[model samples]
Target: MPAYQLYVYEDQEKREALEQKICEQVDACTEVNGKIRNRVKKFLIEEGITDISEMNAALRVRYEGYLERNETVHVPITCLRGFDRIFLHRMKEELKTLAGQRKYTTEYRDQWLCLTHYPDVEVAESFLTSKDGKELVWNFTLECPRKLKMQIFTVLKEVIHTYEGWTRKEKLLALQRLYQFCVVNQVSDIETMTLEEEQKFALKLSEDLGEKKKNAVFGILRMSRKILFLQAPEINWNANVWFLERFHFSKERINPSKPVELVSFKEVTNLENQKILQKYLRYLFGITDLCISTIRIKLLELRTFLVYFNGEEKPIYEVEAEKIQRYLESIQRQDTREKTANGRIFMILQFYNFLVVKRYLKKIPFRYEYYLQKEVHVHNDRSVPEGVYTEILSKLAEFPEHLRLMFLHLWCTGIRGSEVCTLTGDGYEEKDGDYWLKVYQVKMKTYKRIPIPEALYKLVQVYKKKYQIGPEEYLFQNQTGGAFRYGTFRYQMLKYCEKYQIANGEYIFKSHDYRHNLATLYYDSGISLQAVRDYLGHEYEEMTRQYVDYMPKKLEKASEAYFQEETHSFAAELMKGEFHG
Candidate 1:
């Protein structure tokens, strides 16, 4: 590998000296065995080094004997996987030639009759077995290259290693179809392949499979596309080579990015304010690195402040700290939570900072700490009264069993709605005679195995049997098995809100209220607050404290744990017991 790098090394005269020594071998040697140059090339061939740039620092010491006293050293570009940037161009060229595009089009349609049919041609087969054929095989792979001829075959190996789902048989068939698809169709780089070409190939595979063979060939083709998407950027071509006009892969695997809207501030009606607002938002998006969702949320908050100051800034750069304070006071009139008010305050302060940095404002605005609302204790209350919890459960029972299990899974495990949507039918597990609910907590990016009560376990079992759902399908899919996104707690509450409402839908408790109910009740039943914190996946005990309520000291006086038995009443069930639900 080191010797091959020396071929392209910038010091042309010195690299030529090393190349000549390797080519001439013993004849170019000053020493008896000519071991240095001979051994370098021999080591590369023996080690099966295809990408010579993998020549590491330690290996460079082997060439130390040949180094001139003050020569500058170069950095190695190869990654640990032996992926060399230098090999990219040559690999594409070699693959294009091996796929025999010019020969295939010229000969398969016109020239070498003996070899045009490929592998079956006897005289061609004889030539392939000769010395030139031997070189062809060696150049392609360390493996038996005749069978796996294209560069894409090596790429397929990488895909199989990373694909965690498939079995050995499925992968082997995928490989067979991939190699045949590449060579016969003359595809060198699959990432640049068009949608029409992919569809045509998929149709051909379906015809060949017939009724006798199972048609899983499409999976292999998609696998090839995924592999191309992942590896194409590693080469020096167009960085967006993998992007296509079509999206053929799984939406779950790759969530399609929301389309970016083109905003025109001209609709603001005030010309000066529109121009300033446009430039400010454009500057915010361009300068700061934030995800689109976070930026959009911040931008909306900024818009509220802008609307409040609508005609105040005639030239769009005027400021008054008293007016900004009045805006904050108006927001508090809506009974906004302290956290939400703080978020708006945060955005306003940042917008002022941007204006100051741009020199548009000489000096302006109130400091964030001065206008802040006094702490709203009501937002900290996360628990419902025991009677309300019982009512919610009874109302849920009136819904279908699957819908009921959705609430049961969230309430029992204390996982969020986003995590619940991803739960599979096989998420239930038993170990050491105890059932565990597998919870994938998306926010914390961790998994939790919350112990399940028999009531909840039985409820899930009934749901599976009644619905005839497979263990692998999504937990919350529709009756026909289409997935509904877990957008918000509104997905759970809206339908029942009117029935539960004391007035308008404003007073309805959210699905997350069940999380708070469990956290508080668990602690009330003599469970430690630290345990509740861990179960809730809170970053700090302080956040968990916000979720749990203050339990009366007298509630801790019980000799036996109230949660030991699953009940049918207020605080009826906790995480323990074996009663059939």
Candidate 2:
């Protein structure tokens, strides 16, 4: 009496008797599912549909009857549950067989009508090709009235076909949630949702999802509204307000792996504050020469500054030195680092200056120097140790090809992690009998060209060919076909490092350290500070100096050189015997 064999039982009476015995045995068990008992009792009492094939026949007859009545066919939950236990696998096989026979059975309305089995083939196929047809046809179903569902389906058909790439999925997911919200609120049409209704839906999303997902969904909704509005002009949405509340930064400029809140600002509460922040952001974008990355940082810093005054009775325009002081103290209380705290203070001062210039404030409220800290720029010795890197290289062949190549970029060229992740297929060029690599420096907002080892160039060429990367496409792409995220690279590197037990199982790989190593290596080999500055894309000679980690051996050599010189120097003469020995 195998469970699956019960589906093909011909003798109804014997099958019912055996099903009763099985139910009794299940009920006697301590761990029996209550739903199973309930379903079995309901099936036996109400319908007495024990045979699986007969159950399918009954459902088919019901479906035909609904079609005759010009209605959507409905399947009961109990039957679906029973199918889950017995005929779920068989149903899938049957679907495949029906497809082979040129009869498609795609699910349209969940537990209701099949797209192919509908009364009208043309209309059903039209729905199949609409929206994210392939996925939506199989994955989702509308549970509203026929008219409303059709209206939504029409809009979604456009949405799925209109938006491109990853955005299509995002629009679909957000729209599904929106559809549910519409049904719950009894909103007849999605296109005619008022601003108030949209706001209420946003609030509902906030309550339902976590902060990160809420912001992401908010961004998707905001972006998808353009097409939505074009298709349905009656919709009333405050694009300006929504844009400032939560929106995505340019994907080309911002790393996807960065914290969502840092890239997308949603903290400013007051409408006035949001407008001011929006104005500032626009000013930064249009007027300033600052790069998008730098502007994002400044915008995030300013958002924190503005959010502190969210509940204040007075607006942010009424700036006072005491309030600024309190903000500084509050930031300090969080154990903020000196350099970071100084950067934040600088941002605040810059914003206040901008306010004065824009006539938002008659005068500057506070002295910038009064609140600023004198940050001591300490050069951190972040160069990867020789032993650690050597061990990594020893096991590098066993690692994934992408990681190996990325590590080589870090190890040889000393490029930033972000730069490595974003390297384009066209970044490599041949000039003057040497191979050069070009990388877009996000921090500097410029392109930097530097010579690379010939071996690495050949390897990259092979990789590009293998992956079929186009000229403008990223050399290393993520699962979503965007630039390989820096965070993901770092995460994978650490995992592999731990797996391979690099540096005796304790080395925490920092991508920036490779930059330090190459800088130091070049300086020690007699490359000038100016040349290093240009090579590292540092705007200042002093910044390049910080990156060059002068190891103890290099210091010893410098000391020896100074002491061994014939010219009389105070330090050389003072330690003459020690140096001579």
Best by lDDT: 2
Write candidate 1's Cα lDDT for 452-500 as tens digits: 8878887778777876768877767744564435543355456664565
Q: 1-581, model 2: which lDDT tens digit per residue? A: 88667756756667678677555533443332476445544453345454333334335344334334533324343333332333232333345564533433322344433332333344333333333232232223445555456555555666645665467666667766766777778876544445567788889888999777887776644544444444443423322332211333455455433323223334666657666787787787667766566787898899888888877766688756688788876765666668788788888888888888988898877666766676777778888999999999999999999999999999989989988998999999887889999988777667889999999999999999999999999899999887898888999999999999997779998999999999999998999889988999998987897898894467778877885767757665667765577
lDDT against true structure, model 2:
0.67
| Residue pairs in candidate 2 whose N, alpha carbon or C atoms collide under 3 angstroms | 131-157
Best by TM-score: 2
Model 1 alpha-carbon miss at residue 484, Å: 3.4
**TM-score for predicted model 2 compared with the true structure:** 0.62
Q: Which stretches of candidate 2 lie over 4 Å from their true place?
A: 1-265, 332-334, 431-433, 479-481, 551-581
- The superposed Cα distance between candidate 2 and the true structure at residue 67, in angstroms, equals 12
Q: Relative to the unseen true structure, what is the C-alpha lDDT of residue 395 in candidate 1, on a scale of 0 to 100? A: 73
* TM-scores for every candidate against the unseen true structure: 0.42, 0.62
